[model samples]
Target chain A: MALIRKKIVVKNKQGLHARPAALFVQVANKFDSRITVSNDKEEVNGKSIMGILMLGAEKGTLIVIEADGEDAHSAISELEKIISAEEEK
Target chain B: MIELKGIAAASGISIGPAYKIGKEELVIEREPIKEQDIPIQIQLFEESLIKTRREIIELQKRIGLEMGQEEAEIFDAHLLVLEDRMLIEEVISRLKKEKVNVAYIFSGVLKKYIDVFSKIEDEYLKERIADINDVGKRILRHLLGKEKKSLGDLKEKVIVVAHDLSPSDTAAMHKQLVSAFVTDIGGKTSHTAIMAKSLEIPAVVGVEEATVKIKPSDLLIVDGNKGIVIIDPDEKTLQIYGQEEERLKGIAQRFLSVKDAPAATIDGRTIDIYANIEFPDEVPSVKLHGAMGIGLYRTEFFYMNRKDLPLEEEHYQAYKYVAEEMKPYSVIIRTLDLGGDKFLSQFEIPSEMQPFLGWRAIRFCLARPDIFKLQLRAILRASVHGNLKLMYPMISGIEELEQANRILEEAKEELRNKGIPFNNDIPVGAMIEVPSAAMTADILAKQADFFSIGTNDLIQYSLAVDRVNEKVAYLYEPAHPAVLRLIKNIIDAAHNAHIKVGMCGEMAGEPSFALMLLGLGLDEFSMPPQVIPELKYIIRCVTFKQAQEIAHQALMLSTGREVEEFSHAKLNEVLK
Candidate 1:
């Protein structure tokens, strides 16, 4: 399976912090796909809360996310949309 | 037949049926499942999680629509915690290991997390745990075969009796049905408390066990003035409370009608009464209360209520709006006072042991010259439309005052170089809330065009007691001999320099203290817009000479308690 990956800058004022990261996870859980997000040095299950929190992606911090599944293409696109939308507020 | 006492959070009372929000309990029937049925239970749990997640999001959006974003953030955080894989996977792992039904396992795991968060010290952040587990329980119930999670209809004009209300719970409450609230958990500064008061709903918080004893739709009376809750009250008791409500309401209406009336005493003393506004929407409330101007226009609301720093244009619009509305009336705008409990997203400062005594207010502004200059430029531009005066908060010494003035001077020079037209004649002032500022008021007063007493922080820092702490709340008496002496000292210092001094704290709104303030020779009194009429009535009935006499007598008392008792007694004697 091919894994789609990208690093995005958090544009929201509170950082990609707790609430927004949780929101990203909730949106990621929608599709029947396996997703993982990583900061510079660590990788975590996108659906795992401790993993997202451990990522600690603050405002202006670049975060790399990866998705691997039959639906990885659609999942990566959706995940990118969630982070870039600036609508979590 | 029983009476319960609580802290009087707000003034007024209501006699109505008790409307309990009731804890959001999971009510699902569980049946024994064979070991082979574990897979089916797991699938059901997944389905329920999806549906519950959607419902929780919808509820969160609804709350955001109702109460605004700051409150939405509270539930939004809870929603994240609810979806935590750590929590969900932990339950799933237990289900697989124990070979038990998913519903029982989920319920137990949710209970464990709730226990953990309930023990936290910070009340603001601790309330989030209740919200998180509440949604978790709802999901578990759905998996166990419960189809509905609905609270029965509330009575008309009810007072919601609860242990405490989450931000989500309070947001969902029907304002038409729920006229007031009496809760076991919360204080005046609690999020729910601030919400209730902001909505003008009579709320009495910190009533222990109010939800447990008061039955649903039971006739109840909530006395916010006296901090008493009466359950199943007799006819006479109900009538007395009803009459009192009517009287207070009549007074309120009368005040509303004359809110725009010029504030003048019967003895013909015209005192400039202004409103202390936190937001721009509150600008109209100032006019409704007949404020001659906007006294303490708190710019912090813009910083505190949102996630992002307000842009220069956004700041200009808000300042311009109030300045335009109050056209000829002076709108005293304080520069962005960030620090203490109030934080801004733009400034990066380390958290301190004593934030009130740390790099906050004018200190933060002075440190970031560009940020400080941007606000100064905005205020100056807004001043062109109205009588605008810029003030700085928490000024301790003349050096800080001079340093701040230097930045303002630099802003003016830049604007001048750019050929931008701003009100160059705008008056600058400082808040004399710190003891050092008060002690050296003569020096600071010379630098400042005027002085406003921020008594809330003044009393807190002076007495070293957080007014919110129940243990030391009694020490929060504003009329403490030391506090009164400080006020007298500041006024004397300001008057000596021909500078105006005003009060912009809770004490300014209180009727009894208005007389004492005038007696203390305060040139101005800035309070909440709603309190202007009552204070005006009190001010008109008494003369400055009489107030001075009573205030003089009060200052002679030995202890804080004696001063309070004597002042209360003397106020009644004079006002009558």
Candidate 2:
């Protein structure tokens, strides 16, 4: 199995702050694959709220995500979709 | 006795032994006992398990009666964990194998499991550890041969000093004995704060390490206004505070006596006074505080404290209750002012560069027509019970007002087609809370049947300051010249269009700004009901002409301090 890891750019103005982080987490939980997020060198469990909060990645920062398990491809696609979608009203 | 001080979370106090929640170290002390004593320890542990399960049910039942069903469920889950055979079997095995007393064994087994749940990152789930430990402590108290702590056990009034307090723990406290609460964690909008505020208890939170210094029976004084907890206050100081507390109680009673009286000037220029309520349960408080009606009935509270969206009937029942209570008085309902600091977890709103400035208030409602229409239909249906006016928040221009009006028209049409009984001529209004909305007041006034100045958001938005951010919080001044001018302009436009304008924000209750608002020609004032009598007194003391002169002087002041100074001097000059 080929494992893909990449840093997705956050484009929203408020950055990966409260609202967006909540969105990111909710989207990440929709998949069955195991996912982890890393900022610079530190990596945390994607499902762990503290890990996502500790990143404190602002707008325009790069976050690397690694996925494994059966739905890695699909999970990555969903996460990317959430990161790029317009702010939900 | 050890002494510690923390931010007051609830008012009324009691003196008792240090009931440290989340702190328990079990001592076996079995060197003097023989191997045959193990059976006694096991039997004691079994009895404690049964006692704890029964106590949990009692606590859950009491809390269910005091707070509600949902908060009671948190304790119910703890009861389930206590009754689990796996935990009981593990503890029984430990007592026999290690020759430890049942008390020590219970703590050891419970601690291991509690640690596992506490390490979880989910805040909601992590909070469950507090509940479990709460249950564990009850059982330990019985096993360790400690007396059951009851609220009635407190001999005198004392402040509760704790590292942290959960809602259930607070709900279990005696209202008469618990004078005030001091906690080491939680913010102004946390569950602790909300509960305290609802109970009208003076509470200060976020004082870290408060539980380390304050001790039981230390004669502490929690000055909630100053956010200061004075440990071991001298007799003289305590006497002074006691007298002051009594005096304030007398004044509060005086205010209550005039709560139902009409809000009118001494010369009889009657002005409408309304309450800003978030829940249907608070409607009685509005009447108790002498509110003629509800001005800003925020519908968000109905949406909050629930897992899913409220069905139309649930919404209808709440709205109808408040509307029926108000009767002939107008109940202005502001539809779901959600977003910004408050976000719904069930759904996600895309992050914006500026949520306050971008897609929020009416903008979000316009985009999600289904959610907006559901609320509209609910409001319309409730209108049949009493006079209820529907208002839109954050209207910046004529386009937004027209879009919202279009929706209201469609909602009305739907109700009419269904033959539902609703007030077809019910007044629809717009909130002049944004600088843009206030600036374009003339255009908005032409479209909106009424205008209400939401001064809290208006000041924050007008100054480009976030009130929650302490660094820029000083910038939040309702008396700022720009804010005053915007208010004046909006009032003028509304009056010119022959439309009634009212205010339902912090400014409505502030005595310093009462004269200025009246001078600007506001038709109504709405605030927390407790403030109505005092504002009415201020209004009755001065005439419209005198208030105009004060308003003119306040507007000329460049800084907030100057405006405040000017308002005080003018009020004293006129009243005296």
Candidate 3:
């Protein structure tokens, strides 16, 4: 198994808040990859809406997304689309 | 002629037999049980849980179809908390270890959760504690084999007297069969008060000991406009009220005859009569009352009673639903006016000595642009569905108005970039409620497209009287000279700026204030839908000239008492 890692700045205005966090978890759960998102200090499961919200990733915050599985590449790219996309989902 | 004074929750007169609804006081007694019966007790708890789950699911579906899907999702969260493994495990462990009854053990565990959740700083988590308590109560009811009492199927039309009514109870009631409502608790803005106004029933709330004093089947007369309730009246009092009721019924009939007529004065002055609503479900009533449009569609209810903030899609759907329903007619949706007296469980609002004067309405929204922008974006998106306009509540100055407009522009830009459809030319307005806002109407009128006077807050703020406080409630005078001058100033300022002004507060619905407002140059009158017909009848009967003369005289009065007396006398004389 190969591990993929990506660091991205939260671009959406609301950060990883309610609606945005819900969308992030929905996209993260679509792939078979085991995904984890972390700010500098703590790591949380990317597929859990509650976990993602607890990360408190506001706009301009730096966070890292890591995935390990057969579909790690797709999961990372899709998750990044939601996080970096300027328009809210 | 015993008269009990309370808050005038809703307008109109209702005389009927009292129908007392006793509160459901479910007593849970702690009892020791045999250790060997632990398995049976656990089985009983499981069965009750399953039953409660089924009931919640049914309620969710019904509420979704009746209200909106967003509202229905609250039940989904309730279900999740109901099925929480930690809660269930704790209850079972306590039951087994303590060797107590399942009902007692379950309540103990539920209390612990509620206590801890209530202390949390997060408003959302604190709100979720209510869901847990609701679920716990349901399980206890089932465990005790008590049937839930509902007001859905009443056989007679009577005046309902109770301590207080929950939102769900009001929703489940057969509104048509209720002639009036008298409660032991609640103030002007309470759920019961709002519901009574929307349902078009006479109500007097905050009548302490109403449920206890009024026996079932006791003859009662409820004067909602005066906030008076008479129980078991004598012959003379009954005769007087009987004649009054008959006269009111005759007036209502005459009003209905001209329901579809345009609200134009005999002198050819036209006035737009609109309706104020809190729920999307009230749109039908707005139209039924022959309203020209919705002047104030409150958006606060969407933010209430839940753990999570409403998503943009939810706001869009609710706004779109109201706009689409009132096609060709304007729907002025106000932004979230939370905080102060109307606190959201989802936010941690520090307790204030005077909440009404604290951080509230537009102030709260401005502080949290992220939440405010989400709502603005939703309203803009729904603007394309119909004639949708948006307004900001509790805007006290030009700076707040400018800042709100700037954020609105940003929301519009966001939508434009995403290629989402919206009415770019939607009119923006500000509510002239605070005394400062009324005083600065000229400055605000320059930046805002329109103004709607919210007299409820205006009166309270000007008089420095809390409408909810019984001791000082009498000082919350709507006919005060200061309030009248402020209203006149706002209307004059808006007109001078070439913008239309309207009133959508309780003052707009008061019969005595109708002619005064019309004469004061109010372009529109938006009130509870039920009062539209009668107010329209008043408009049609009087000439604009007569109203202007009466208003002029009232403005010269020295005291609120004089103003009230003059208006009352003039109303009777002119209507006759």
Candidate of highest DockQ? 1
Q: Which is better, 2 or 3, measured by TM-score? A: 2
Total backbone clashes of candidate 2, pairs 3 or more residues apart or in separate chains: 26
lDDT score of model 2? 0.73
- Best candidate (score: TM-score): 2
- Across B51-144, the per-residue lDDT of candidate 2 in tens digits comes to 8787778876876565545456556456555655457777878777887667777787787776755554544444445556677777878887
* Interface residue Cα RMSD of candidate 3 after superposition: 10.9
- Residue B426's lDDT within candidate 3 is 90
The TM-score obtained for chain B by all candidates, in the order given, is: 0.75, 0.74, 0.69
The CA lDDT at B78 in model 1 is 59
lDDT of 2 at B219: 61
**TM-score of chain A by itself in each prediction:** 0.82, 0.83, 0.95
The best candidate in terms of lDDT: 3
State the lDDT at B467 in candidate 3. 79
The true-versus-predicted C-alpha distance at residue B173 of model 3, in Å, is 7.8
Instruction: Give the share of true interchain contacts found in each model.
Output: 0.29, 0.00, 0.00
Instruction: Give the alpha carbon lDDT tens digit for every residue of B236-313 in model 1.
Output: 998888898898777667656556666666566778888888778667657766788888998876664233567778
Model 3 docking tier (incorrect/acceptable/medium/high) = incorrect
Compute the DockQ of candidate 3: 0.03
Better of 2 and 3 by DockQ: 2
DockQ for model 1 equals 0.14
